[model samples]
Target: MDALQSSLLHQSALSYAYPLYRNLLDNSIVFLYHGPITPDLVVDILSLVENRLDDTGEDRRISKKLFNIMVESFSLGEDVERGHAVLLVRQLPYLYTVAIGRRIASSAVYQVKAFLDWVNTLSPEALREAYQRQLEKDDPRNLSLVGGVPAISILDLARKSHGILNYNFEYLNDSDTFFSLEARLQKTI
Candidate 1:
């Protein structure tokens, strides 16, 4: 009876939680949460990340910018999922990045690719101007649930911060694919 109990406990502990806990410790993860997206969850996460950024003694302006970008990213992901999504954030010395992945309807792939490509073609100044133009629109929410204003804002931020905006798509069987989008913010030294 003792051996069986010990085996069960050991297996359970080694399965999921242990590796995740180890990674969290090893990676200096300031914020990590993935599950259902609720208003409360978003609020709590913003507060936690805000405090963590404060502790790092970073510039107040940069910290605020990063926080707002994060909130918009979370909001975008939640909108995509309608309830659930995955948000992964990693903090490094000079680079802070967040990748939000969600299952998206495959029909939207071309549109997403086109949008990214168009943004890629713009110079920093041009991007900023385009973003302002987007902001001038009344309502830009499409069927995909990605708001134009926030998307343009994020792209503008990525450009101004000398960071990168990237994406990857993996087909999940048929009629759907997992879309992972990442935005990075590089600290200027």
Candidate 2:
């Protein structure tokens, strides 16, 4: 009877996990990481992603854009040490999507949402101009500014992705919210 119960538990776990496994496969996920973001981990992830992009023979420009977006996205989180984040890279039919999800202080949710919304409305040229303006006004070297508010890195990501930045904020509690940002790069001919 105990053996049968153990088998049933294993089957149930498999049943729950199969769909998630299938979803990853269906999404053409090239890279997926869910953990504390560290400097060394970022380097390793970038190296793996670079190799994967090369192996797939992705267009040079698109790969570079994706790489830039990943770097910017990873750095957007001002308090990465305080939360574990998820980073996913997937290939779609027309473009490659790089997504980073992290938890942020609820106080900054409005600023992040506003910034992303404004960015989404900009044309490529306007986005580039915004990037330049922010670069001039803000110190890009200091990523942790304004108490976890994403500064120039967000603008750089918007420009690198050609304004194809998508973001969402989910309220987790009174003090923290889940922030998801996605940047898409068009596959060039």
Q: Which candidate's TM-score is highest? A: 2
lDDT of 2 by residue, 1-189 (tens): 699997886676767698888889998987888888878888998889889889989888888888888988888653556578889988889988888888888898877777778878888788888777777777556543433756577777777876568888899998888888888888863
Q: Model 1 segments beyond 4 Å from truth? A: 1-14, 25-28, 80-83, 140-161
User: Of the candidates shown, which would achieve the greatest lDDT relative to the real structure?
Assistant: 2
True-structure RMSD, every candidate: 5.4, 4.8
- Candidate 1: residue pairs that collide: none
> What would the TM-scores of all predictions be?
0.77, 0.83
Worst 10 residues of 1 by lDDT: 141-150
Q: List the residue pairs that clash in candidate 2.
A: none
> What lDDT is reached at residue 56 by model 2?
84
Each prediction's total of clashing residue pairs, residues at least 3 apart in sequence or on different chains, is 0, 0
Candidate 2 matches the true fold with a TM-score of 0.83
